[model samples]
Target: MGILDQNIDYDRPVKLADGVFWVGFADLEGRLQCNPYLIVDGDEAILIDGGSRPDFSTVMRKVLQTGVSPRQISHLIYQHYDPDLCGSIPNLESLIDSAELKIISHADNNPFIRHYSVNSPLLCIDRLERKLTMRSGRTLRFFRTPYAHSAGSFITYDETSGILFTSDLFGSAGAFSNWRLFADFDKKCLGCEVAHPERPDEHCKETASPCPWSGMHHFHRKVMPGNRQLRHAMKVVKAIGATMAAPQHGSILYRVEDIAAAIERLQRMDDIGIDGIADAASCPA
Candidate 1:
C-alpha cells in the first residue's frame, strides 16, 4: 500500500527509515507546522531542529515514543538560530541533564542560539569537518545553505538513510486542511507535469489543492531571501543525491520524483525576497 493508505498514528513517532523517526507535532490548526526529526543509531541519539518552547511537551512525547530516552540524545543539531528550531534547547538540556550533550550548529548561528540559555556545549559543525559519526558508524554530513532563510542555515544528510533534513529550503505552509506527513499530489499537478504543459510557464499558486508544489512555491517566496540563494541551495541538494527530504515546516518528500520536482521548482522560482518587493513596488496600486 502507498504511504497515504497506511494507518499512521500521528501521536506516536513515525519511522522514516531504519533509525530515523519523525518526532514532530502535527498541529492541523497552525499555518506552519514544525517538523523535528530524531535519529537513533545504536545507543546514540540526535535530535534535528527541535521545535519551539510551546511544542516541547508534544515533541518530547513523540521522541520518547521512539524508544529513545532524552538522555540518549547526545547531540541536538540546529540548522539555524530560528526560535522555531532552537527555542527549546534549554528545556531539552534540562531534561537530558548531561554535560556531554552538545548543541551542534554552524558558528554563525551559535551566538544567536546561546540566547536560549542553553546549558550544553555549542559545537560548530565546521570544527567537526562538517560531519558527525554515530556509535553505529552511521554518518551525517552538514551542508551550508546560507541565505536560503538564515545566514547560518544548513541541512543534514543522513548517509545511511539518504534522508536530507532540510531546514526551510523545502518548507510549505498551506496544507493545514489536508495535512499529511508525506507529500500528496494530483496526477496533473506541477510536480507530475514538470514541464508545466497545461499552464505553460504559469506555476501553480493554488495552495488549497493537494499539490505540494503550490504550497512549496508559496513558502519559498515568503521565507527564502532570493532566487539566487535558493538556486545555490538547490545545487547543494542536487549534489547530495538525497533520496528523501524532510523539511522543518512541511510535509516530507519521500519519493525521488517529488524531491527532484521540488528542487527544480525552487531553482526556477522568481520574485522572492527583495525581488518580490521590487515586483510589488512596480505594480500600480
Candidate 2:
C-alpha cells in the first residue's frame, strides 16, 4: 500500500452493515483520525469509543442526525482507557444526559479513571466467560489478552458480524479515506507513519513510556510479551473467523481473510527478533 500523508475529509455515518456505522475524524495527510462506532437498533444505541475532545462536535451532530436523542446513547464501551479512546467522555456527557451511559471497559482499566471516567455511569467487565449480546444483536465475546498492547487489556469479538474491535493490537497508519483491510493497506504500501510538515518521519520510531490517553505507565519487562499474546489472540480470532478489525484510530477494515494472513506474517516476524514493542508516539489517533 502506498502511504499517502494528506489532510483527510472528515465524513459521517459510513455504513458498515445493517446497524453498524463509523464516525471518523480527519488527521494530517490521511494518517491519523479517531474512529468511533455507533451501533444502533431501534431506540437504543451504543458508542464503542468516544472520539477526541475536538471530534465530539462531529459526533454529537451525527448522533442527532440518526433521529436519536442524546439520551438514547445507552452505552459507551472503552476498549482501553486511552485518551483517544475515551477522552471526550466528560465533554460528551456535558452535552447529553449520560445518566443512562453504561461505561464498559476491561476490568483492569476501571481504576485508571482518576477524573475522566470516575463519576459517569459504567460497567467494567474484567473477565470473559460467555458471549455478550447487545440489544442490536451485536454479540461481543472477549479473550483475556493481558499486555498484548496494553496491560490488563482484552480484545473483543462480535459473533453476529464476526468483527473484532481490537484496541491497539496489530494497528497501523492510514487516514479515514484510505483505510481498507490490512492486506489492502499493506499491498498499497501504507505504513503507520503519517506525514507532518514539520516532522514527516517523527512518528516512525518506537519507544516505551506512559500511555498519553490514560496516563498508564508501560515497560518492556515481560519476556516475549507481545508475541505471546498476539499468537494467542490470532488463534482466538481465527477460531471465530473475524473479518473486520475496528480500532480506536485509523480505518474500519473489511478484509477478514487478509487480516488472518497478516496475523500469521506478524507471528513469523516475532520469531525472527522483531520485537512487538512500538513507540507509543507512533500510535496516531
Candidate 3:
C-alpha cells in the first residue's frame, strides 16, 4: 500500500522493513509530527526516539500493536535530549520495568536527558565503540552529527535494514493536513522544472513550491546551526549509504533516489540557522 493512502490505518504499527516498525502517534493536526521507530531483532527490541509525555499512550499502543511488549524493549536510543524525543523516559521505564533496559545516547546528551528522571542506566555510545550489536547479530552503528541541531545530535544506521534514523538532521516540518509518510517526489519535481518554473536555468536546490523540498528547506533553515554543520552531517549520511532515511519528524525517504536528492539539495543550500536570521542583529537595543 502507498504510504499516503488515507485508508491505511495509522493507529497500527506500520512496518517499514522486515522487522522495523514506525510506532509513532500520527497526530494529524500537529504541524510537527514526531516519529518513534521500533527495531525488533529476534526476541530483543530497540526503541528509537520515543515521543513526548503526552504522546506516550498512543506511541505505547502502536508499540504493542507490533506484538512486542514493553518488557521486550531492551534499549531506548535517544539521538538528542529533546523532550519530544525522550520526555516519556520515566513513563516508559515504569512500563518496561526491566533492570536490563538501557538508555543509549551520546555522553554529551546524557546530562540533559537525565533531567527527565530516567532511571535506566545511560549507555554512552561513544564509550561502547559507537555501535550496538543485538543478540541476533544485527549491528547498529552510530555516527555523531554534532551541532546539526544539538550538541549531542547523532544518527543511527541499522546495518541489517540499511535504514538511517537521522534524529533531526533530515527532518521536515509539514502540516498534518497534507502530510505524507514518504517523500515520493513526482517526475516534474525530479527535473527541477516544477520547483523553479520561472528560473529553469538556475540550479534549484529548494523552492516555495509544494513538495518535500519546501518542507525540508523550511525546517533546516530554522533548526540547523549553519551550512558547515549541515554539510558535516550530510557527509556522514552519504558515507553510510543507507537505503532509506527515517527522521524524527515528517516523512520518511524510502526511495534511494529520493534520499540522494535530499542529500544533494541540503548540501548546496545555504543560509541556515543563525545565518538565516536577517534583522535579529539589527534589533533596537
Candidate 4:
C-alpha cells in the first residue's frame, strides 16, 4: 500500500511489452491498483488476472480500448481468486461471446471460479510437463508455486517475449506512476529514494510524515506466510531467462540484474526471517 508522488494515466491500459498490456483499474487515490495483463497476438488474445468485482466496468472499458474483442480472448488465466484475481468472471463470461473461452489454473481454483459461473471450463496445468501451447502458436509454461500466497498459486512464462507472469512475487508498491513498457531497473534499485511515498492511512488522510517504500516488503509479508514458500518460489523462478517479470500488484521488472537482485532481496528476507502475514502483529512494515 503506497500512495504516489507522480502523475500517471490511470484511466486506460498501459503497454508493458509488444502484444502485452496492463489493463487493471485503481481507486482515484491510486492505492488499491490491482493489476491485470492482456496478451494479444493477431486476433487471438489472453487475459491474466481480472480485477475485483467493483473493477469490472473500468477494466473492461480499458481492455476494450485496446481493440481486442471479447471473442478474441480464447483463454483466461487467473493467478488466484482472492477478489483481486478472478472477481470479474461473471462479467467476462457474459461479455465474451466465445464458446472456446477455456480457463487455465490450478484445480483448487475450480470451486472459486465456478462460484461466479459454472460455464467457464477450466483446464488444470501440469506440474511435471508445465506448459500449455495455445492454438495461436504461443506457449505458456506454468510453475506451480503452491502456498507462496495462495494454496493454488502458480505462474506463467511466455516463451515468445521472454516474460514471466508471476502472480505476486517480486511485486513493489506505487506502480501506477512508475509504470513503463520496460522496467526501470536503475531507479527501482534505489527503492523509495526516487519517490517519497506516504503510507495508505496517511495518504488517504492527506497528512504528512512521508515514508520510504520497503519494495514489496509489505505485500510479500501480508500475502505470503514466510520464507519456506519464498525459497521454493525463488528456486522455481531462478535462472528462467526471463527478460521481464510481470506481477499482479507491482511494476514489472525488466533487466537481468534487476530480476536477480529481486531474487536476492527475497533470499535475504528469508534469511532474516521477516514476515508480513496480516494476523502477525509482530511483523513490522
Residue 279 miss distance in model 2 (angstroms): 17
TM-score per candidate, chains pooled: 0.90, 0.71, 0.90, 0.79
Model 4 per-residue lDDT at 16: 62
* 192-280: candidate 3 lDDT, tens digit per residue: 52332123223334543356666677788878988889999999999999999999988898888888888998887766877667875
lDDT of each: 0.84, 0.57, 0.85, 0.71
Q: How accurate is candidate 4 locally (lDDT)?
A: 0.71
270: Cα error in model 2, Å: 2.1
Model 2 alpha-carbon miss at residue 67, Å? 3.1
Global Cα lDDT for candidate 1: 0.84
Look at candidate 3 and give me any clashing residue pairs.
none
Tens-place lDDT per residue, model 4, 105-131, is 888766777776647678777643668
List runs of model 4 lying over 4 Å from the truth.
1-8, 28-30, 127-129, 173-213, 271-285
Give the alpha carbon lDDT tens digit for every residue of 81-174 in model 2: 7777777888777766766666777667777743584567556564435346677566777766666655656667766656677666555442
